[model samples]
Each structure stands twice: as structure tokens, then as C-alpha cells.
Target: MIETIVFDVGETLTRDDCYWNLWADWLGIPRHTLSALVGAVVAQGLDNAEALRLVRPGIDLAAEYHAREAAGRGECLDESDLYDDVHPGLSALQQLGVRVVIAGNQTGRVGELLRGLDLPADVIVTSAEWGVAKPQPEFFHRVLEVAQAAPDETLYVGDHPANDIFPAKAAGLRAAHIRRGPWGHLWADAPEVVAAADWRIDSLTQLVDVVRA
Candidate 1:
């Protein structure tokens, strides 16, 4: 039985529309343009930051991010940014004694933002906090360490296959490919995702039955 459930942030737990829209406003670009580039990079399996580079060649993203913060425009989130099913799904799991963890590749400010939401998760952390990003073995290693459960008994759920499914499987954790968001729905039936994911689900609510079964 799955004793612990670890979730990915973008698309899996929270919709990233606001997050990226803020970026669009920050970079003075059309939202659709950046959104399109994001899709293009994901389709090509390029790092997500590549999308920004594609838009503004030679742009220093880290510096720009700090500048945006200094301008009082940085990463932000709220209940509205979350999917409708996040609370129902996680709360049900918590009631069932399943440990729920929210970890993802997000800025440290996002870590604070998520904590502010007060989601029903035992632990909420981010890549920025750990200084390691997803698709890195050490990241999953730390996930397993925090889970306090055997890798096989812990499930890592996310929308990105290369970053979430493949890496979680490689780390011996069961992986669930969530079919929402651009990455999720687009890659839902991709050969590699279909082959690698231990489970492919469309709704966070479905996780209840997943844990029970």
C-alpha cells in the first residue's frame, strides 16, 4: 500500500497561469508569446528556462527575477491559483493516514507562498530551498529522505514526464503522471510517458481510490 504521497507543484497542485502571467507582465511580452514558447520547449524536452532565453536572448534571468522582486513583482500564489481538486484530494489522503508532501521546482518565495495557503500537507518544500532541481537524482534522494518511507511505498506525482515520472521511477519511487496542464494533457499518451508512469490519472480526486486500491 502507498503510505506516502508526494506531489509536484506546477500543474499538479497549482495552475501556473498566474505565475507565468506575472512573468509576461514583468518581461513586457505578450502572455501568449511566452506561453507558446513554454510549450515549444517542453515539446522539445528543453529546460523550461530556455523559453525565456528564446524570447529575450542573452537575458540574465536571475538578475531580472531579482529586479522584478525589487519592483514589487515576483512570484505570487493564492487559493485561486490551485486546482479545484487539490484540497479534496490531499485532505482525503490525510484523513486516511497517508503522508502528504508538496515538493516541486519553484522559487523559495513560492515555498513561502505555498505555506501561506495552509494546504493540508505534512511538508511543503521547493527546489530553491534544497538547492537542487527535479530530474536530479539527489532531488529524488532528498524526497525519499523526507518521505521517511521506502521509495517503493512513496509515490511521486507530477505533470512532467522527464522531470517527474522518469526520475521518480529511476529513484525507485512509484510515479503517477497527472493529466492536466499543458505538459500533462499533451504528453498523456506519449509512448515514453505511457510506458514509464506507474499510474496515469486525470484528477487529483482520483488519488483517493488509487491509495485505497
Candidate 2:
């Protein structure tokens, strides 16, 4: 039985494509250029912080990204973007006796986002705060520890196969892929990437059934 569910924030739970669009707008560059820039940074093999520093000079990339989102939408970037029925879904999960946690590369803002939405998860595991990135067994193991869940009893859902599915499966958790529209298209040619997931769903609402089953 699945006693716990862990979710990835960006792309998976949140509207990351919208966020990326805001970033592109703020940078006054084409969206694909920004995408390519990220690809270039990764191609050079820089760590997250180093890659951000090298590519987005003179800026805290995460902060700037949030600022752009807030400005463009005229609202604070809250965790509501993570799910449409944020409170309802969480309440339903809690009522069903399932513990929910969030595991992601948060760069320090996810806690604030969750707080703003008033959706305090059972636990939060972040790469920026944890000093480890997903796809690494250590990161998922940390979340498993905090959730007090046996790997087999937990389910991990995320959009990125490499960052989400692969490590979660390797760590012994069941994995699910949440396909985030345009952003998911970026991996269209890579079927092998998502092969690690035990199941795949297009929306967060669909997770309820997967967990209940």
C-alpha cells in the first residue's frame, strides 16, 4: 500500500512553462534562446549554482525568475500554481490517510511558496537546501527518511524523468510521470528517460486514483 506521496514542484506540480515564459520576457530574449542557454550551461557540466552564476550574471536566477512571474501576473508566485485544487486535493489525501511530501530542487523559495498557499506538506526535501540534486539516491533517501516511509510504500511524481523518475525508482519508490504540456515536449524524443516511471499521468488530479489504487 502507498502510504506516502512525494511531488516535484517545478514543471510537475507548478506551472513552470508559464514561469519560464516570464523569465524569457524579463530577459527580453526569445524563449528558445533561454532554453538553449540552459542547455549550453548543462553541456559545459556546471553544477546548479555555478551554472546559474555563469549563465545569468549579476542576478540570483531564482529570485529574478520569481520576480518576473510576480510582475507579469500581478500576483505573488505562490504554491497555488502547484495544483489547481490545492487545498481540496491535499485534504482529500489527508482524509484518506496518505502522507504527502514535496521533494524538489527548491533554490530556497519552495517553503515560502508553500507557506503562501497555506499548504504545509508533511515534509519537504529540496536540493538547494539539502546540498544534493535529484537523480541522486542520497536525495530521495533523505526524503524517505523524513517521510518515515519505506521506499516501497512511497510514490514519487514529477515531470522530469532524470530528476524525478530515475532516482525515485533507483531509491525503491514507485514513480509516476506528470506530463507538463509544452515543457514536456522538450523530452519528446527521449522515450528512455521516462521509462523508469511505474505509471504516467497528465494531471495532478489523476494522482488521487493512483495512490488510492
Candidate whose TM-score is highest: 1
Per-residue lDDT of model 2, residues 73-125, tens digit only: 42235654665755666667777888988778776555565555656467765
lDDT of 2: 0.69
| Per-model TM-score on C-alpha atoms | 0.97, 0.73
Best by lDDT: 1
TM-score: model 1 vs. ground truth = 0.97
Error of 1 at 174 (Å): 0.4
lDDT of each: 0.93, 0.69
For candidate 2, the C-alpha RMSD (Å) to the true structure equals 4.9
